[model samples]
Each structure stands twice: as structure tokens, then as C-alpha cells.
Target: MADTVADLLIDRLIDWGVDTVFGLPGDGINGLFESLRRRQDRIKLVQVRHEEAAALAACGYAKFTRRLGVCLATSGPGGLHLVNGLYDAKSDGQPVLAITGHTYHDLIGTRYQQDVDLERVLGDVAAYSERVMSASHVCNVVDEAVKTAIARRTVAHITVPKDIQDWPSSGPRSKANVARHSGDLYADAMPLPPQSALQKAADLLNSGSRVAILAGRGCLTARKELLAVAEKLGAPIVKALLGKAVVPDDHPLTTGGIGLLGTAPSQEVLEGCDRLLIAGSSFPYLEFYPRPNQARAVQIDLDPSRIGLRYPVEIGLTGHCWDVLRGLLPLIEDKSDRSFLTQAQQRMAQWNELMETRATRNDLPMKPQVVARTLNEFLQDDAVICCDTGTVTTWAARHILIRGAMEFSASGTLATMGNGLAYSIGAAVAFPGRQVVCFAGDGGLTMLMGELATIAKYRLPVKVIVIKNNQLGMIKWEQLAFEGNPQYGVQLQPIDFAGVARACGVPGWHLADPRLARGVLKEAFDQPGPALVEAEVDPNEPPLPGKLTTDQAWQFVKALAKGQPDRWDIIRTVVENKIREVV
Candidate 1:
């Protein structure tokens, strides 16, 4: 049924239900591209501007769809460019397959053009890496790569030499006796914890009155189970950033996000609770969690290594979130005392009030919080929000309320800067009818600005809101907060992002006035095609944590005393923003 090794590989991918692939073609991968061209009706390649975006788009597609994402690239630098995005996939535990080309078989060891050893280069980021040595090896290698990626929830790589890709697809020699593989592999069934382990976890959760639940990305599909457990325990749900959409913010028991970009209510509950249940989250900040001896904890995770990673747990149950929660629900007793849940809800209300006050502030350069809040007001009920890493993350985490069927994600563990636009592209392609929005900082947007052309060419209805602060806002604050140092080398030159978007054949708007934000955002979202909005926000605004530590306070003072730029403005802005909460 196949003509060549490349054709066989493509056919196998199609058999696995892969309809879309993100890639950029080059000479090294011409053989594979030719096969793709011939099989155009079976599968479609979504050409991207850069190979890095291709990989990131694949990661995004996987995160949103819960399916295997595939990306392709040529040899040498093209393959090297995929490393950052592949690491993003690896760190975030997304299933992705990366296909790359290599130099001719004979010239690989020699210093031939584009003869870099990609297998070794991608070794650290990929869970499985292989190079097809023969035409008969292509099908087996591709099958293995796909199986490994999906089963392990990690990145997998396959490299095909240029000459090998064009060779005829042949069966193994009769005497050689090489094993053949099938393409019918599917995701493994959801695992359930042992009944004894589930009972122990349930007993621990039932014993405490002040129970708190920490949810993360793994809880995405287990929302119903998570809420049922929370209701039974009378617990408050504090979400990690990646799990923002697991439970709606409007839910009475939801205490909002945890850690630096988290909410005040989340901090209060985590600090004050007597018992904690971590469901499918490996939140890294130990300080944000309860003191080791203060609370008895139970953890449920799909990975055994992550069970007690962030907290000391009385019981560690290794299983899928949905399965474990279902197993534990029947054994759990409904908590009669509603005191803890009521207190958490009250705190969440006060936090919401404080956020409103901050968002309404009429600062001259426009507070980024205002931009995020305004965008939230205009977001579709089921919109997909992709945010970049920076101060933009703070605004999105704190202001954007994920409700209905909304989905949200970013470079959570990897914290990469340039993934917002590429992620939005992937979301747009995956669900063409849904509203997809990207919140990007000026620095992050500039890193992969070339993708605007890709969006325009596809005419996707994605809305890009660039928070134009003209600086690396997050790094600037981290310098002062973590190191007690003045900001240096963080400033960025202002650019007319809207102009660039227009040049790329997309509608664009530039808004500097806070009063015009809502109108401009509505216009941008109303556009049938992709659009960009450049909202100039204040650079001096600090992204304060949910609860300021004494050490962080001292660091802020030390940096100010050491001649931090805009010292007076920073002081004024911080005081103005926090004054109400303090009162």
C-alpha cells in the first residue's frame, strides 16, 4: 500500500488518526515533504514561520485536545530550534512527537552540511529518541515514538536520513528476523489506586475539619470528581495556574490560584487549614503550602514520583485523578461543619472586591490589570485563553475569570516567553469555531512576532492583546524581590505592535488610554479575522504577591534605597494598590 519509506510513515500517521501536522519545510526534509504533498488529502501540514513555533503549536494542540501532537522540521538548526518548545512539552508533561530530517546516511559521520547529531541533541528533552537505520525500520520507529510519547505523556523524537526517506518500503529479510510493529496503539486505560490506599486517603480527608484542596493541570478532566470531594470535605479549592479552569472562579468553594500570581484567599486557606488534599497537582512552592507539621495531607497523582514531591503526605495514592477521586468519594464522609468553607468563601469575596478596586484605578500610563480585567469582560463564555510568561501572567491569573467551558494554559513548568502566539495558533486550528485569545507581554510577543503572518494566512479568528510595558516586567520585579537589586538591563524599546500586525495583513489597534480599552478590545474581537491590540501599560506597576513576606518587604526597601529606577512611582503605585486591602 506504500511506495517509499516516507510514504509508509505518512500512512502510518494517518492510521493513528493524525489529521494535522505543524512544520516548516527545507531541503533536508524534501523527501518527507514530497510524500506529504502526495498524501495531501489524507493529512494536512500547517506550515509555520519558524520551527520553534511548530513545536510549540504541537504542544498547545496536545494540551487542549488530549491527543498526540506532531511537529516536523529539517536538520541542523531547524532541529535545534525545536529544543526549547520540546522542553516546554516535556516539562509540562504533554504528549508530542517531533520528526526531523538528517544528513545523507553516508555523510552523517563526516562533516557534511547540516550533519548535526540530532538524536543526541534532543536526548535530554525527549523520553524516546531514535534514528531510522533502514527503510524497514521507519514504520516500527514511528510506531514506537508515538506509543512512547502518549504512554509516558512526554516528547518523542524520530530522525530519518534524507536518503533513507526515499528508499522503497520493504519487509524485513526472511533470515534477518526483525520484529514488525503495528500502528493500532492507543492511550493506556486510566489507572485506579488500590482499594486499601483509597480507603486510607479517605480516612485522612474525613478526619480534619479545616480541609483544603490544591488542584493542578491533571485535574482538568476530573472537575466533577474534584468538586464532589470538595463538597464532601467542606474544603476550599485552591488551583495552580495551569489548573485555573479546572473549577470555575465563580464557584463558591473556589479560593482561586496559588503561589506568586495567586489570590489572597488561596494564601489564607493554605496557611490556615488543618488538613490538605492535593489532587493531581505538583505545585513547586513549598512555602505557599501548609507547614509540614501543621496539617495532615493526602496526595493523589498519576506519577508515583510526584506523590509527596511538594508536601509530606499521610497517604499517597498513585492513579488518575478521575479514578482516584471516584474511588475515594464513597468512603469519604460529608463534613457537617460548614465553618471552614464559609470562611474561605468570605475571604474570596473580599479578594474579589480588592481586585475590582485595583482594576478600576485610573493611572496615567494605564495599569496592566485594567487591560486584563477589561479583556475578561469581553471574553466569550467558552473562550480559550493562552497567556505568556511575565507580568502578563500575573494579570491574567488574577483578573481573567475562567468560566463555562473556557480553557487556559501557558508555559507553566518551563516558563518560556515566546509561546503565547504559537499556542493561540494551535488552539485556533484545533477548534476553528471557538474564540481564542492570547495575552502576551511586549517582550514575549516580540520573540515570535513572525507568526503573525501564519495567523493572517490562515485567517483564524484569534485576538492578540499585547501588554505594551516596554520592559521585562517580571524580571524587573524578581530582581528587587528576590535579590534586593535595582533593575538593570530590563528595559525594552517601545514598538508599534499594531503597525506590525497591520503589515502582516491583520487588523490592528493601538490603545494607550484606559478609558478606550473596552471599546478597542470589543472592536478587535468583533473582527472576523485575526487581530492585534497594543495596550500601553504602566512599567512602574509592581505585581505584588498574594501575601507579602517580611524578607520580600526588606528586599523591596533595600532595592529602593540602592537607587532603583522610578523609586517614587513604584512606592506610590504599591501604596495606592494595597491601601484598601490593608484597611
Candidate 2:
């Protein structure tokens, strides 16, 4: 008998250097699962309890490794379950490949059991989606899927019919077949901006007395070149959330994040700058940016469409950041002015002091900022932090400083809940030696509490810190800011996440008292395997931004007038926090 379609696909995956896959088994994918079992020596399959976890694991793997993350699922409901995680990958611009088993070829499109329009459903999230019909097309489809995912830095999907997965291969079976199909879509050649565009950008930056650089994830590979330009121009670097680790936080010219999750110094840099140099970030919040035409802007992006999307660009260099910056640096004049850089550094120092004070407060219920700052203190230099969406994002973005080889990521565009646990699983799986810590809120942790079982099963060394506020803290603040409305259904019953982790066979620590948080957290981190720390954080603390707009203040006032039972208490807490800011 000739080789089965599953054999060829497995060979291709091995060829692509994929050592492991995250997936769930279902009857529709029986043929594929059986083949995987037979090939267990060559490929490792991590059987997750939910298909969503599989997809999210893949997303987390891709983000942590910067490699193509692969996940698999069965037909119909199984495939649908992978949607959210796939969207998480797509939105974050991570490369991921999803394989799904479909109904038998003849059974497709005839109201077959467990059959869905896989391609159409995933088309929006995947850069490439295809259905494999015959063994003859298997190799080609697999090749295209891997290549497209890598080149586009997005999701690529392929569905294999149950019957077709067991069919005799029409193509060669081993490494020869894989080598023949392997092709580098992104070769050594890098895209560079034209001389005219480069020169014009240099001229604008050279003339400006106050220049600010905003870098994003796109500048990840060009850190050396980025710092050189910043130094030459004497510009303070403001990071987008994705760019948090691009430049060291303690750098003389570095002013933390630039939007609502940004620092006061970062806002100051943008407000006073004459020239704004944006690198590889399509930061969507335009209001937080310098107003249109307020500063001469130079944006560098590989995609031409994104060059002028957020801010009107006086000079747009449509090329890779490293290439464009390298060319532009030579033509630019060095600015010796230290005023902008010195002033930004001073503001950053003050902001740091203020944050430290808030983080060290010994409140009855532990302050979330204190937990965030405590985690920051104990984190290893190479720690990878996976943060859940909600107020947890604010604590992580604002309080945690990225330094000494640290990396932080969250569900950026999609902002999905329960991402911290899933992403941590992927990171731990991908980098078994590196410390993976997840920052989650009670709301987010409860959503995927089952993943603790996955961690226990794999014995993955992941540490999760739950900020147990018993409320959707972010939404509570939003309700007050947007409509001055007293929090409605935002409250959550207190859950002992650490106890849940213990029930799942992972170790747990409960910090009922905030003062013992640091000591308890250190013990949890010292454990050899998966563990959790459930710290009770103050529910009333709001994640106020660097600047609260007038409209937001007015809405808050109106809400207060509507008078909820605890309106006065809530108002008093808000006033106290604001007073701390002014003082």
C-alpha cells in the first residue's frame, strides 16, 4: 500500500521543523489522530481539553517564538472553537497554521454530519485558507499554507477530508518531497525606501528642534538602528504597547508608552515635539497622538497603506524599518540639543516615583498596582509575561517596567479575556526553560480555569497571578468615565483561583492579606512546576489614565448625581486617587 495523506502531511510538518502541535481529537479527525498516534515518535501532539485552548496555545507559541505556530482541530464545532484564538493570532500579526479535519469528500456540501464551510468562516482571520480534496493536492496545499503564514505573518488554514486523509499519496513520501516544495517567500532581499523619500525624511527630522520617536513591534529586529537614530536626533523614544521592550525603559531618551496606557512623560514628548518619527506602529488611538499637522511626521512601515493611516505623514517611507532608518540616518544632521531629552528624563523620573508610591501602599485589600509592582520586582530578566485583557492590562502596561530582557504581550486588537492563561501555556510549552508568568484578573481567570488541568498534565512551569478584585474593574471605571453611571452588573463573586489551581493538581497560594503578597509570591515562583497566587486587590481602585479628558470627567459627574447606594463612598475613593495624582 502507498503512503497515506496523513503521512505526507506529517512529513511536511516535520520538514518545517515543527516539534509539537496543540490539538483536540474528535471522530471526524479520527484518521488524522490515528496517524498522529502512529507517528508519535516523530511528532508530539498536546491534547488540550478544548479546541480554543489549542488555537490559543498556538497563538501564544507564535508570539513567544516568532515562529509558525501550528494547531489542529476536528470539523464543524471543533473548527468553530478555534476562531477566537485564530483571531487573536491574526490581530496580533503572529504567524500560525491551523489544520482541521473535514467530513468525507462525498459527504461535503450534502448536509453531512459535522461539516461546515471552514474556509469561508476562517477567511476573515486567515491570510490563506484552503480545503484539500485529493492526495495529489496535499503537498502543494501544505507548502502554500506554511509559506503564506510565514510571509504574511498571519493565520493560514487547511482542511483535510476524513476519507482523503487515508488515501494513497500521489506524491513522493519523505524528505525529498519536502525539500522539493520548500521555498523561501521572504528571501535575503529587504525592501528599502527610495533615495528621494529617505532624503526628505532626513531633512524634516534634521530641522526639528524637538523630535520624538514612537516605535512599535515592527521595529523588533531593528533595535540597534533605532537607538542610533534616536541618539543622533536627541529624541525621546515613546513606545506603543507592542513596542514596550523595543527600547530599554531606563534609557536616557526613553519615555514609556504613549496612549492611555502611556506615561506622562510620553504624553509630554508627543505634545511638545516638532517632529514625530513613527516606526512600525499602527497605534489606533489617534487622539493621544499629536494632532494632525501639529508636528511634521515621518512614518516608516513595510505596508504602504499604513504609512499615513493614523497621523498625516509629511514623509512616508514605505519599506522595512531597519532599511529605511539605515538609509535616512546618513543624510540627517545630528542635533546636539539635550533640552528635550533631559526634560523627558526628569518627567519620567517623577512618574516612576509616583507609581512606586501607589504600588507600595498598604491598603486593606491589596492594591493591584502593588501586586503588579511586586511581580515586576521578582521577575527574572528573561521572563515572558502574558497579560489578560481588562484592568489587568492597565496594571501591566502602566505599572510593570519592561527591562533586562523581559517581554510582555496580550490579546492586543481582539482584547479577548482568558488570554493570559492560554498564552502562558503556549509560552511555557515553547520555551520550557524560560519563566512564563501570566497576569490575570478574577473575571479572566474564571473563564479558562480549566487550563490549569492542561498545565498540571504537562507539568509546564507557568506561574499565574490573579488580581482578585471581584469586579470587572476596567468596565466599572469605564461606566463612571463614559456615563457617570454607577457600576451595574460588573461585580463578580470572589473566587479563590489559587484553590482552583490546587484542585487541578497545581500548587496554589492565597494572599488574603496584601502585606504578605511579596513573600507568598516569591515562594510560589520558587516552585519547580505550575502554580498560582490569588491576591485580593482593592475593587475600588480605578486605572486612571495620564490625562482624563473633560468629557470623561463630565460624564463621571452626571453619573454621580444619579445617586447609587454607594455613590458617596465611590466618589470619595475617586477623589482620593485624583488628589494623589495632583499632589
lDDT of 1: 0.91
Model 1 lDDT, residue 496, Cα: 93
Taking the tens digit of each residue's C-alpha lDDT, what string does model 2 give over 222-328?
88899999999999999988788887777777888877778888998999998999999988788888976789999998878788888999888887888888898
Instruction: Put down candidate 1 lDDT per residue, 1-583, tens digits, no spaces.
Output: 6888888889889988898899999888998899999988989899999999999999999999989999999999889999999999999999999999999999998999999999999998998999988767777788888999998999999999998888888745445535564556675767888898888888888999899999999999999999999999999999999999999988998999999999989999999999999988888878899987999999988888898899999899888899889889999999999899999999889889988988887768898989999998888889999999999999999999999999999998889999999999889999999999999999999999999999999998889999998999999999999889999999999899999999999899999899998899989988888999999999988898988899999998999999997999899988866685587
What's the TM for model 1?
0.98
Q: In TM-score terms, which candidate is top?
A: 1
Error at 407, model 1, angstroms: 0.3
Given candidate 2, what's the lDDT at residue 230?
Answer: 94
Off by over 4 Å in 1: 171-180, 580-583
TM-score of every model? 0.98, 0.95
For residue 315, model 2's alpha carbon misses the true position, in angstroms, by: 2.1
Model 1: residue 461 alpha-carbon error in angstroms: 1.2
